[model samples]
Target: MAGSSFDNLPLEWIRAFEAAARMGSFTAAAVETGLTQSAISQRIGHLERRLGTRLFVRQARSIALTVEGDAWLPHVRTALESLRESSEALFGVARDRLTISASTSVIDLWITPRLDRLTQAIGGQITFRTMVLSTDAPHDDDTVRIRYGTGDWPQTYKQPLFSEVMAPVAAPALLHKDEAWQDLPRIAVSGPRPGWTEWCALTGTPTVPIPVLRFDTFASALAAARAGRGVLLASLPLCAADLSSGTLARIGDATLPHHATYWLIASKERLSRTQWGALSGALTLR
Candidate 1:
C-alpha cells in the first residue's frame, strides 16, 4: 500500500514544529505551549520523520532551523493565522477582557486619567502591561499597544494618539513671579524626544543653563519637575492634566512640534471594526 501525502500530519506536530522553530529551543517552545521539553522534542521528531526531512539541527546547547524549515515557516504561520482568524470569525465567543501594552510614562500620564471614559467606551475589563523599555515589543496576547513612532507599522490598525508638542515646563514654586524660567536649573530626560538643545535652537536662544538633574525615563523627569527640581522639556499632551490642575506651568509661549509621537496600534485581525472604532475614538486627542 502507498502512503498518503497528508498521512501522519497532525496539528500538534505542526504546532510543535512552529513553536520550536520560532523560539529556537524545544524547552522554550514547551514552556510557551504548556508542554514538557521531552514532549515538544518528540512531537518535532515525529513531524520531521513524517515529512521525510530534518527541520532542526540540534546542538548540545541550542537548536537551529534547517534551510527547508526556514523556508516553510512563513507558509505555516500564514496557514495557522488563517485558521485562527477564520475560527474566530465564525464561532468565537465574544470576550470582554482586553489587554494593553505601553510604556510606564504613557500608562501613567495618559491612560490613567482616561480610564473611566475608556471603560465606558469599550464596556470591558482592561488589563495593562507596563513596558520598562521604549523598544519593548507587544506580546501576542496584547490586544492593543501604545507605541512611539511615525505610524508605519504593517498589518495593524494605527492612529496617532496625540500630536506631540514639547515645551519647557516647571513647578510654580521653582519660578519666582516675573522672573525668567530659562535661567533656572534644567531637568534633562534622555530619550528620542527633543531636548533643550533643539528647543533653544528653535526659539533662537543662544544657550541655556546646563542640566542639573538627568533621568532616563520621562516619568522620572516629570516627577522631578513636579517636585520643584528644575525646568523640564515636557510633552504638552502628556502633561495636560498637570498643566490644567496647576501642578506644572508652561515656561513660555514657545512650543516644538515633532513628526514622531505616540500611536495607538492593534493588529487588524485581532480586533473587530466596532471594537477598534470604540478603542481609537475613546483615546484619540480631540
Candidate 2:
C-alpha cells in the first residue's frame, strides 16, 4: 500500500489497531480506549481494510498478532513513550517542579539548609523525599538521588558532590578546653560506615574500647551527640549545622578523610546540563 493510503486512514483506526494488537482482544482495547467493544472491532476492521492485511488472527477467548502487527508493536510503543517524554520535558514537568531524593541526614543537614537558594536560582518549587539509604540503594528514575560512595555507580550519571570528612564532636559543656577527649564516651553509627576504629586509624589516635555506645541509625547517634551523651565521630555533611551553631563542638584537632564520599547520581537522559548545574550549585555553596 502507498504511504498516502496510510495518511487517508483515520488516526483513530490506527490507534484502535495498536491497542487491539497490544491487548490481544477487541474487548481489552475497548476498555483501554474507553469505547465499546463493537466500536473497537469496527475500527480495527477499518484499519485492516486500509492496510489490505490481517493484523491479528481472531480466535475464541484470545487473539494473536500477525507477523506484521508483532513487528509494528515496538515502533508504536516507542512513539508513545517519546511523545510523553518530549511533552513533559518541553512543558516543564508540572510547570518547573523538581523532585529530589536523598538520605534523611543529607536532606536534613545539607540540602534543606540551602533550599531557599535553590528555589531562587531555579525559579521553581522544589519537593524533597527522604530515605535512610546506603551507597547500595536502588537507583530511582523519578527523583535525583544523592548517595554516599565513590562516584562510580553503574547505570547513573554520577558526580562527586563532596569529599566527606569526619571529626569527633560533642556538647561543649562535656569537655574543657585542654581536657583530653581520648577517653571520653564514643558514639558510633552501626550503618554502612567506617567506625571510630577507622577514624582513629586515619587521625593517628590509638583506639580505645571503653564506654562505646552504638546506634543502629545516624539520627539516633546524632540525637545522642546533641544531648551531650558522648562525642560523636560524625561526617561533616551530617552534622554541618550542629558544627556551625556550636551546639556540637569538635573535641579534638583531628579531622580525618571519610571512606565514603557524597555523590549526586541521576539519569543523564532525564536531565540537561543547565538543570543539573542549577541544582548542584544550590546544594553546595561552593
Q: List the residue pairs that clash in candidate 1.
A: none
Q: Score every model by TM-score.
A: 0.66, 0.61
- lDDT tens digits, residue span 160-195, model 2: 667787788898887764657887787888776677
Worst 10 residues of 2 by lDDT: 134-143
For all predictions, the C-alpha RMSD in Å is: 7.5, 9.5
Over 141-189, each residue of candidate 1 has an lDDT whose tens digit, in order, gives 8888888878877645898999999998999988875667767889998
Query: What lDDT would each prediction earn against the true structure?
Result: 0.86, 0.76
Candidate 1 matches the true fold with a TM-score of 0.66
Scored by lDDT, the top model is 1
Which candidate tops TM-score?
1
